[model samples]
Target: MQNRLITCTLLLAALGGLSACNKNKGGKSDVTGWNYNDGKKSSGFYVAKPKDIKTGPGLVFVQGGTFTMGATQEDVMGDWNNVPRRVTINSFFIDKTEVANVHYREYLYWLENVFQDPQYEAVVKGAKPDTLVWRSELSYNEPLVEYYFRHPSYNYYPVVGVTWKQAYDFCIWRTDRVNEKELIDKGYQNQNVLKQELNGGGQDNFNTKSYLMGEYQGVPGKPKKNPLKDAQGRPRNTVKFEDGILLPDYRLPTEAEWEYAALGLINENPSPRRSEKQRGEELISNRQMYSWKNDGYDNLRATRKGNWQGAFLANFKRGNGDYMGTPGGLNDRSAYPADVNSFFPNGFGLYNMSGNVNEWVADVYRPTTNQDEDDLSPYRGNEFKTVDVSGGEGNLRDSLGRIKYVNENDSSLRNRFNYQRSYAVNFLDGDSLSSSSYGYGITTLISDKSRVIKGGSWNDMPYWLSPGTRRFLQEDQSSSTVGFRCAMTHYGAPEGAGSKHKTGNFFPTRRQKR
Candidate 1:
């Protein structure tokens, strides 16, 4: 026994030396130390340093918390759809304000310039807002129809007349633009790459997935020293995603995330000790009717002292025919949708969460989603797919220069134990014999095309201004009273360290030996 103990001690000492030697002269881990090389030849392997996550432009981090999702006030509509339920939301970054007319115009400008071909012209045109949506049969809205989006005066207003599909496409475009700019700023690529003219429109666009998969390459720039060496000790020519340089893809906020953010209940619920020890004891004080300080709907005045004292809290219809307020003393100040940042922000520092244009969320419409969804970070829509390997070179690019993906099939996923199905889009709402009994189209108006729209619009009454009040619209249909904001998943913690929440550690804790 004494001999065995001494042997173990010696082995541990050797491991300590091994760890110290694995670090390079610069104090970074050398990839070679990980024993990653195959027998074939010398290759590059990167040990990426963790990067500081910079908040994307126009975004506010919504430090997530537990809250009762659904109607906070009386269900005046009698829908019973939004039955209150407890749910926990994960922290995520969201646009501080709605996407404005100027933002949409920038997207359009890129579309027009990149996709100038006759075949792609239709694609560009489809992205344009339906200006005619502003027109009404009785009202003379001709001026609004022509000028709402194009006029400089309305440039800062939340963009409307955009379909859910169009908003989703805009998110994708924004992600690529932001990431491409990041690479350029880091000197990984040339600054003039964005300026280079391509013959096939979107075919040469910088899609994040495509670029990472080695399927797309921009204009050549000053190449960095590749860690992987060839037979002759020459550097390689590729950049891998493991370098931790790219940002995550932006998407529409899920239904639970949106509702949780809009409520911004964190300010009302104070946790003296935010550790796991006190998690269950954190108490939510007053239930909110609007995204504001008071439970009363009529209390629109700013509680804090400043120039904002007695100012309206949000932009919405006060009563029947009372859009703004009487004459000179306009209550909410605007008859139409106001500037995206006009009103006071919620507890999460997000503007117009309760009133403005109703925003589209990334949820398939289902009245029963609350009952069936997971308590933690609840969401409804998910469609599983795998990278297509049929072309032999698995990462083969299609004509559009995007990596191709196919729905997972039973034969290909034979050994997988967790998932046996190809698609999960309608996983919980399709057939009775399946996991979920809620039927789509056949028994209800809910279909794959139906998407959830949350918050209230400028045309909406006070009842509709509640954050929990949800409605549905077809994905392809545009609406003058609806708009959207983008969201990005938070990579690390639920409550970001040094943030207002001051709760749990920002990263995973190392497991203790038993």
Candidate 2:
């Protein structure tokens, strides 16, 4: 009541605007007769049912469907890793272009500013991409090591020398930053606090999970702008995840999601044409060898009679010592990784899915995990963790000011209502109790730490260009050939299209025999 009276401006327009009242907002509760978003002492269950979530920036929505997720072409290298198997992928959003040098530099700038204190200097240094990855004992590419990352000339080029772990960390930072912006935009958080934190080098940096879990108590927005209230109709400042404001965590795309996206199979369907009652024919008879077309080992170039006739479509080595084609007719046009925006995009309007640079994905490299993994959204690198909230409201957090997660192991599951098996990285694939074949650092270099790298790099051969073909490297190790892109899990309808032009039939719920 004190806050309500204090905000005389909002009080004047209380009847018109959505001001806090002792009643529900509008919707009646389905479970109970009581109302929702109601500030009443009897029932104060705030609920937010947004029509649809805002798609994250630079993301292209890839519709979910069943696809043959393994090698479409002959595995010439004789690595029986990616065997052909039908698997379904859930709808998710992926970055339209690979993470470029400019994008990464922005992240580094933030880290440098925020973690300016001497104690946090290691955080800044660790985030920097390995610029020295460009050096090779045989090659004279010394200039690239100095200029590639620092120079503005390669701003839009894909950021290489980023390890799988670094790429993963980048995604975590991105999630907090993106969500922080969202809160600021909605007037839930004070926008000036961001600049203040940067300048002051404050440890109270805004993190999405920390904010939601009541860990970080940063500056709140104006009272009138917030307009939230408690059960007693007093002003409530904090925003919750249930309020439908914050976004899902931005993370590395799972290997299945990455491959499914790389293979832009949408163009293969006859989706351009649809009927009144029924939609277009949902069919893909052929498995795509490359991201460009269904054809195997053909001229993947501009065959149409125009200025760009016979131009190379992707960046890949044609043969040994063939980085670029020739002096006059430089096929693929790029000797090294090309500008991310310069590539002729695949059918999904996603650039450099087949080349430019190989990408880091969220998966433990197991040769036959696909055979045992779940058919729906198949993946293998799930080391389950719970947000550690040991001290009630005050939770343990990282240097970035996010919730410090406790590994969801068996012993930690004592007081927990829910459960997830922890450290399942090599559970069925190469565990001591399970299969003893592919011994880590012994029988094979493959280990739980070996993360999957997808899509062929600029120096890679045509055989590696296939979406199904995969390779792996140690998670901590960085390479000049490797880069990464981020992905976000999609909520609501898989179609993404709303009710108006929705495809497929929605049958009525079956009456339960009481």
Q: Which model scores highest in TM-score? A: 2
Supply the TM-score for candidate 2. Answer: 0.88
Whole-model lDDT for model 1 versus the true structure? 0.76
lDDT of each: 0.76, 0.79
| Backbone clashes, candidate 1 | 1
- TM-scores across all candidates? 0.83, 0.88
- Each prediction's RMSD over C-alphas, in Å, is 8.3, 6.8
lDDT string, candidate 1, 183-223, tens digits: 77766678777876344456787887777666677864555
For model 1, the stretches where C-alpha displacement exceeds 4 angstroms are 1-44, 197-202, 223-238, 269-281, 294-298, 303-307, 391-395, 410-417, 434-444, 497-514
> Model 1, poorest ten-residue lDDT window?
35-44
Candidate 1 residue 251 C-alpha distance from true site, Å: 0.7
